[model samples]
Target: MKKTGLFYGVNTKKTAQIGKQIQEAFGTDQVDIVPIEEAWKTDFEHYDNLIVGASTWFDGELPTYWDELIPELVSLDLSGKKVAIFGLGDQAGYPDNFVDGVGILADAFELAGATLVGFTSTEGYDFNKSRAVRNNQFLGLVLDLENQSDLTAKRIAAWVKQLKKEWAE
Candidate 1:
């Protein structure tokens, strides 16, 4: 199997920790954990499969690292690439816009011509609204580390399992 590029913001403690957990779950050899700060347009060109992660900031904005890199990322011709997205948010604190960062990244990657995968159901969440939701499903996996930390590992495992199957198709 080709190794996946797991790109995330290194400065984001929670997102970084979650990225590490994901890498461990997939086995370190199967994934490359790259800090978004160090990723270039050419770096994305190295892998056809990618796992991108983000942490939602105040008012449902993406963290600076992700926000800054998006323009550069979208500039690439990602026609044949497959991208999956994951995000961390405080559902209880930001119920109005839970996990909007995932949606933002989804749009950016779509604009870049990548095939987005890992659409997940929004069951068991207490959010009032989100940009991440489309056709009644989240554009990607959503994890609430603040209110639902206990479910993180299980969610990641299930999502990774799902991604493996989806990518295979």
Candidate 2:
């Protein structure tokens, strides 16, 4: 069976918590939860599927650790790998740049030739603008933990279901 890896960059623990939620929803021992600090040592080729999580910083930047890991991520041969992304951001606070960190990661993965999956609809979210949105869709799952914490679990569950379908295909 192909293994799954969940890697995350955390600051306020919201991203970490979302990673944990995904780990639980996947319900498989083959899944590995790795912090961005240690993800540099991870063998990207070992996992057939990768789920990356990050919390957006001011002005739509990725968390510091994710920014640091980008070089290593870019150095990997991720072609044919299934990659998914998730991000935590404060839409109420940063309406102009909500969850843009996910877009940065998505771009990096795309550049590495990974097959990015799990793009989510931007229907219910209220944000003025975001790099994460393209053609009225988020690059991946996006959580507004500061303003919409109540929807996190449901959104995660739905996204995980979508991922399962995508990975199986």
Candidate 3:
């Protein structure tokens, strides 16, 4: 299997922590954590499989670094790449726009021609609205570290397992 690049914003502690957990779950040999702070277009183009994550900012906006990288990311031709997104949000605090960063990133990757994977059910979340949801399922893994911190590990493990299967196909 090709090594997966796990890219995330290093400034956000929670998102970075979650990225680390994902790397550990896949084992360092199979996953590499790349800080979005230091990432270049080549980083996105180099990996066939990628796990990218971000934290949702106020009013459902993506973090600063991710927001700034949007144009560059959209310009890429990721025709055969596989991307799985994960986001950190406070559902109880931002119910109206829970996990919007995931949706935003998902859209950028889709526009770049990546085959997105790891769509998860939106069953247990309590939110009024979210762009991340489509057909009643989340675009990717959604972790509410504020309201659902206990479930983070389990969710990451399950998502990684799902990615392994999806990437195989």
Candidate 4:
């Protein structure tokens, strides 16, 4: 059995809702969800899979907790860990920096040697720019609850299915 850990930082609770939905989809017994405020207490090395999430803040910055968490992430060796990411952003409000926080987290994990999974297609999303975009795809699942709340459930369902397959590989 693979143990999974989910860590997230949220502002308007939308990101937290998304995290909860993902947790439900993955099964409560399989995932341990931790808010970013308490993430330092989590033992990342204990999980076989990791899911990190955050809402993009002003000017493409990561959420507050992530600012503190980044250093800890850098010090850990995550080689061979299966990591996935999710982020919330308002494309209409911050078109140029949409979901950039997800990219930031992804980069940190990559630097720590984690194998990031769940790259999502950029189709159906309206945004001028995002650091999360690499090769025309989001480095992870990107949700725009401010602009597209209706799509969240379906998107999460598909992403969770994708992650399950990726984890199996």
Number of the predicted model whose TM-score against the real structure is largest = 3
Alpha-carbon TM-score of each model against the true structure = 0.97, 0.94, 0.98, 0.95
Q: Best by lDDT, which number?
A: 3
Question: What would the per-residue lDDT of candidate 4 be over residues 1-169, giving only the tens digit for each residue?
Answer: 4889998854448778888899999999889987678766347777889999989999999877898889889778888899999998999999999999989998899988899999999999988999999999999999988889999999999999999999999
The sequence of per-residue lDDT tens digits that candidate 3 reaches over residues 11-66 is: 88899889899999888889888899889999999899999999999999998999
lDDT-based ranking, best first? 3, 1, 4, 2
Considering lDDT, which of the candidate structures 1 and 2 is the better prediction for this target? 1
Which ranges of candidate 2 are over 4 A from the true structure? 10-12
Per-residue accuracy of model 2 over 1-169 as CA lDDT, tens digit each: 3689888854447777888889898885857887676666356777899999898998999877889878878778898999999998988899999999988999999888899999999988888999898888999999988888999999999999999999989
Give me candidate 1's TM-score against the actual structure. Answer: 0.97
Pairs of residues clashing in candidate 4: none
What C-alpha lDDT, on a 0 to 100 scale, does residue 150 get in candidate 2?
92
Model 1: lDDT of residue 77? 92
Q: Count the backbone clashes (under 3 Å) in each candidate.
A: 0, 0, 0, 0
For residue 9, what is the lDDT in candidate 1?
90
Local lDDT at 21 for model 3: 93
Q: What ranges in model 3 sit over 4 Å off?
A: none
As for candidate 3, its clashing pairs are: none
lDDT of 4 at 157: 96
Error of 3 at 87 (Å): 0.2
